[model samples]
Target: MDTMRDRFAPVVSQVLDEDPRVAVVLAEIGAADFQETARRHPDRVVNVGIREQLLVGAGAGLALTGMRPVLHTFASFLVERPFEQVKLDLGHQGLGAVLVSAAASFDWPAGGFTHMAPGDVALLDTLDGWTVHVPGHPDEAETLLRHAIAAGDDRVYVRLSLQANRAGHPVDGKRPLTVREGRSGVVVAVGPMLDAVLAATEGLDVSVLYTTTVRPFDTAALRRATASAGTDVVLVEPYLAGTSTAVVNDALADLPHRVLGLGVGRGELRRYGTLEEHVAAHGLDAGSLRERISAFLARRDAVPAAS
Candidate 1:
C-alpha cells in the first residue's frame, strides 16, 4: 500500500492539470517526484531550492495574486523553520495556501532529530484560522488534499506521513466518523494513530471516533459521543502528546469529564531506531495504549457518581 506521502505527488499533479489557478511551491524536498509535473506546467510548479522561507513566501505571493498555492516540504522545515513566513506571509496577510508536509513526527528517524516534527500540529494550533488535516490513509490524504485545494482562500495544512492504517475510513472533512459504539468512554484517534487506538480499545466498552480533520474540531460529534458514553475521553494522536487536550477540555467544560491525552511524548529519543521502536518507546504501541487507557478509565469508573 502506498503511504500518504507517496500519494501526494500524483494527486497534486492531477489537480494542477485540471485547475489553472492551482500552483505548487516546493523547497527542494520532493522536487524529484514533481519533475514531470513541473515540466508540464512550468509556470505553475515552482521549486525554490533549499530555502524554506522563500518557499512559503512564494506560495503566499501566489495566493496574493488570486492563485491557490500548495506548498510541500518536510514538516521540520515546512512548518518549524519557516514558521515566521507562515505566520506573517500567510496568517497575518489572511492568505490561503495548502501546506503539505512529509516525514511526520519520526518518520525519518535515521535523519536524526532535525527531521522530526511532532509539534507541527500543536505549533499551528497556536495560530488562528488554520485548517489542519491528518489523514490516516493515502485515500483519505487524497480526499483532504482536494478538499484543501478547493477551500477557496482559506489557510489549510495537509499533514502527510509514511505511517498509515490498514484501511482508510470515510472522511467527509466536516465531522468525526464513529468507528465503534460503546457506553464507557470515547477514544478519539487522529490520523495514522487509528489502528493502534482501535487495537488498544478492542473488547472495551468505549466508542471510537476517527477523524482526519483536526482543525475546526468536531465539537458536536464529540459532545454527542460523550453524552451517550460517559464523560471520559482518550485522545490518541500521532504527534505530540496532549496536543489537543486543551481543546478537549474546552469542549467538555460544561460537563465533568476525564481526558487522557496520548501520543508522542516531548522527551527526545537520541537513538535512531525503527519506527516501531520509536512507537514502543513513546508508549504509543497497542499494548501500552491499552494499559494506559484501561487504567485511566478504571480510575474514572471508580469515582462515585453525583447523587
Candidate 2:
C-alpha cells in the first residue's frame, strides 16, 4: 500500500509533466520526497530553501509570469511560518498557486507537536477567495489536485498526508463523499479514517459525511445531510478537537443542533510504532470507535428524549 503522497504525486506529476507551462516549487524538506518528479520535469522544480515567505512570494511571481506553480511544504510551516507571504502574496494578490501541504496534523510522528498542524482547517477558512481541501484518501487527493490545477483559483491550500490509505474508496469530486443515506447521526470524517468509521457503524442508522473541501464548505449539502438528523450528529476528525470545534460551532450557531466533535485529545502520542499502532493508541481504531459509539448510543437512550 502506497502512502497518500505517493498515490497523488505520481498522478499529478504525470499531468503536470504534460503541461509545458506548469512548474513546481518545493521547500527544502519536501525536495527529497518529490525529487524524482522534479527531476523528470527539471525545468519545473524550484527549490526555495528555508524561507517559506520567499517560497510563496516566488511562487506567486512565477505564476504571474504565466507558469503554473505547485508549492510544496510542511503544513505547519505553510501556515505558521509563512502566514504573511501567503496572506499578502497569494491570498491578497489573487495569484494562481497550488499549495500542496505534506504531513498535515500528526501525520509526521517523528516531528513531534511543534510540527503537528491542527489549526490549518480553521486558519485557512478565514482566508477569502482561497480554496481549502482536506482529502480523506489518496484518490480524493488526486481528484482535488486535478481540480485545483485546472481551477486557476488565486490560492488553493491542500491539507495532505503521507499516511497509507486503502485503495478503491469512492471519492465524490463534485460533492462531499457521502457513504450512506444522508440521515440522522452522521459521522463526518476528514482523513482516511472514514473507512474505519464505516466499518464501525455497520448495521447502525448513521450517515458518513466525508469532507474533502474544508474551507468554503458546501453548506447546502451539509445542511441536507443533517436535515433528517434530529440531534445525533458527530464529527470524527484526525486532527485535534479544536479543528472541528470551530467548524461545528459556527455551523450550529444559527440552527438548533447538537454536534459532537471527536479527535485526538491532550496526550502523548506514541513515537515508536507502526501507523496502525499509533492509530490504535489514539482511539482511532475501528473497534475503539465502535465501542465509543455504542456507549454514546447507550447514554443517549438513558437520557429522557427531549420533552
How does each model score on lDDT? 0.92, 0.71
- The residue ranges of model 2 lying beyond 4 angstroms of the native Cα positions read 32-43, 182-184, 245-254, 266-274, 295-307
> Model 1, which residues run further than 4 Å from truth?
301-307
Backbone clashes in candidate 1 total 0
Tens digits of per-residue lDDT for model 1 on 1-307?
Answer: 9889888899999999999999999988889999999899999999999999999999999998999999999999999999999999999999999999999999999999999999999999999999999999999999999999999899999999888999998898888999999999999999898999989999999999998999989888999999999888889999999888888889989899888888899899999999889999999899999999998888865652210
TM-score per candidate, in order?
A: 0.97, 0.84
Return the lDDT, model 2, position 121. 63
Clashing pairs for model 1 are none
lDDT of 2 by residue, 106-136 (tens): 7767777667776666666667877777777
The per-residue C-alpha lDDT of model 2 at residue 191 equals 63
- Span of 10 residues, lowest total lDDT, candidate 2: 298-307
Question: What lDDT, from 0 to 1, does candidate 2 have?
Answer: 0.71
